[model samples]
Target: MTWLPLLAAGPALAATTSRPWGVLCVGLLAAVLGAVLGIRDGVPGHELAIVLSALVAVTLASGLASALRVRRERVLAAVRSVAEAAQHALLKPVPATVGPFQVAVRYSAADAEARIGGDLYALVPTPYGVRLIVGDVRGKGLPAVGTAALVLGVFREAAYDEPDLLDVVGRIERSLARNLGPDDFVTAVVAGYPGAGRMEVVNCGHAPPLMVRDSHVMAVAPTHPTPPLGLRALTGETPSLQTLPFTDGDQLLLYTDGVTEARNHEREFYPLAERVARHMSDEPSRTLAALHDELLAYVGGRLHDDAALLLLRKPAAVGSAPAAESRASVGEPTRPSLLQ
Candidate 1:
């Protein structure tokens, strides 16, 4: 009689890792064993019946629980699949090389299950030159994701249509003004690599981009302070275009606040410029990968906010190449050309 009570544990334990049918089999075995033990103990008929009844009840309940658990897991799997599809659609993957620059990107969402958050980046070859934007939307979750999608959509279209870098920023500002709430705003840095070895950067109240020159890393602060994307009306300040020389062997890194603000157990912020100098490499991908790994380790495994890093390195010209105009026709597209 004492041993018969332990039988209920078998079905309960099996429910965790087995199907309903498996739980039923475990319960059946347990019930048969319990009956034999009760008979051998010469327990009274009424007590034996009570013990058997309890065991049977536990089995049925465990089986139902197992079925419910499996169903919930399937539903979760389907939700994860849809989230992945949405991530790919919203944040299209960037190729290793875009135009003449070697490009690399690393992104992490605070919500591990979401796969994407408010951080956004886009790099595409335009008729003007290779252009890119790195920005962070206010807040998190689905609203933040929606704002990110809106910003990227406007940037991709404006990058090809607008000749001037500032014009591209204007287009985004106007679009956001119409859509975003009063307090919602996005901080962004829009950049273009036109001819003349000069890169045009428009800072819209975001983190200054870091430029690596001759093994040195320096922040490219905005010439004029400006409000974020949706706050032009409140501040009445406009973003200014700062042009910097981008020559061979030069690299530029644009990242969101999540990277810089990440803290360790000691609460020390990650030193991005120093790490970038330390991890400098000919390949942009390798550089970002090292930084990404270090960032994760610094935060003790997971980030609490959305983080994004985009690195662009201009390699030395190999030899004589076709004219910019000729290459423009082949590279210029509405969407970035995915590398094979």
Candidate 2:
């Protein structure tokens, strides 16, 4: 470990700050004086014994401090390991490709202290088609994380069982209704590709998704206004479904409010659509990388809220796998092996 030497030196360095060096210097000086006196008077002196005892005590204290530092480092390392496991459990990574589209995800939690936060995104090739969801919970921290987990849990199961895009959303709505608090809700955009150059999007009071077509970018906002999930009881309203043409070479970008709301030093919100227009390309991953960097630069380094970006682009040709059978081509879910 690179930190080993630093950790070992911590106690000794701290002891120096506590004036141990001065004590050692004084003791040595006293011993020297005592030796001279003893030589002149032909008598043994207490100063020499006191200096030896002081040296022994300092050695013992230094050892004790080093042991404590090592223990603290071990505890911190274990805590970091557990945090990493939690992050992996919450934010499972998406493959480079899913169904008939190339996929890439870029996520950052505002709370840099923790790996996982409130924002959530997932893309799964289900029996119905390639289904995806990007949402932001009402609050931050652990409670928001729990809500996000609940939404994804329902989406993953419903995406496989329900063929209809609306039905998949309904499952998540019902789950949130039963689980969330009165004041809590989630703003989300759930999307799916059933086939034939058509993409269905259901917006639930979230930011509109941006679509890139032939070097042009536009927001895919729903025609009808809808309340966010979990607040359906309050509004008695349901999310509206939007079906749009997604031809080959076209790209779709789904993101949370964090992207739009991110501000630079001058307190200006990041212009997402304009930036996407500038960065749209054949590779979804590369486009997202550029956007992510610009976003960090815009925010002056750290984002103040959880941000998630999910990009999907249809290839020019379906290749060996037909669009109808794209679900079968999806690889198994990749789960990180936590330290056992």
Candidate 3:
């Protein structure tokens, strides 16, 4: 959480303005100052010429050094700014608190900042319920980022105004159909956590989200899933929503392919499900900490894509669990009242 933004801006700031490019500017300034000093001190001899020469040499060297650093810094800063904008667009700044869940997300791009990869998640409180989307766009750089923004924009609007999950998905499909390249498509899972304690999920060929219960981790997968969002037109019936039994104190983990697809030094994939199942914690924050740490350790701090993680805690339910059969017999139509 603490590891974001470069703290070493001292060099960048000094190198940018009025010859801020570190060494060059410094050297030039030093030379000018030296000449002024020589004049004031009245040394108009061979010694003065030698001092001027040294000052000129030093100034040129310093200027070059500073310019190189400034160039590097500007590129990094540009990248950071882009990543920040993408994050804002993807996350949409939901209220810090919603329902019994306190959600927090972290995204780290494979490149220092300027690198273009978009791993996205968006949560919007809608008339139908609280709708959210989490997924990774294919490719890297601006193309991927553009796709991410496109998907998020469609989902945000559709979630609020559309009642059916399929309809919301349809909106995104139409939007992408007009823009996405023939080979480009995003993989994702769009979900509606309609308040109370139930979740409606539509899997669009994305990684299965993890559900944490009493410290146990299980993947929340749909029984039937469609292809990723943009390719929906290629497929027939949309994926059906699978209702989940969410309770207070339960946590839902949504992530991008970056986390699961990470490769280790041995070239083996990061074992996200296995690791999460083994390390899940009762506390949402703690669970995330453990997962994030293990992820970083697995890849040795190198990631290949924009990795994102969103943790949601439903808060603890007041009453006892309904009979196991109760969930089997119940349907989503009857669940909205549970929010009360």
Per-residue alpha-carbon lDDT of candidate 1 for residues 97-204, written as tens digits (9 for 90 to 100): 888899999999999999999999999899999999999999999999999999999999999999999999999999999999999999999999997677899989
Task: Give, for candidate 3, the lowest lDDT window spanning 10 residues.
Answer: 1-10
TM-score of 1: 0.91
In order, how many clashes per candidate? 0, 0, 16
Please provide TM-scores, in order, for all candidate models, with all chains considered together.
Answer: 0.91, 0.78, 0.75
RMSD to native, candidate 2:
10.0
lDDT of 2: 0.78
- Which tens-of-lDDT digit does each residue in 233-258 have in candidate 3? 67665667788877666677899878
Query: If both were scored by lDDT, which would come out higher, candidate 1 or candidate 2?
Result: 1
Ranking by lDDT: 1, 2, 3
Candidate 2: where is the Cα deviation over 4 Å?
Answer: 1-65, 318-340
Residues 1-340, candidate 2: write the lDDT tens digits: 1221222233345544434454444444444554555456644446445544544555457656555666777798897788789777777889999988899999988977687888998888987789999999999878998998899889889999998898988999899989988999999999999987788999999887877766766677678878999888888887778888776777888999888889899988888877887788889899999999999999999999889999999897835443442222111221211100
Model 2 lDDT at residue 46: 61
Worst 10-residue stretch by lDDT in candidate 2? 331-340
Superior candidate under TM-score, 1 versus 2 = 1
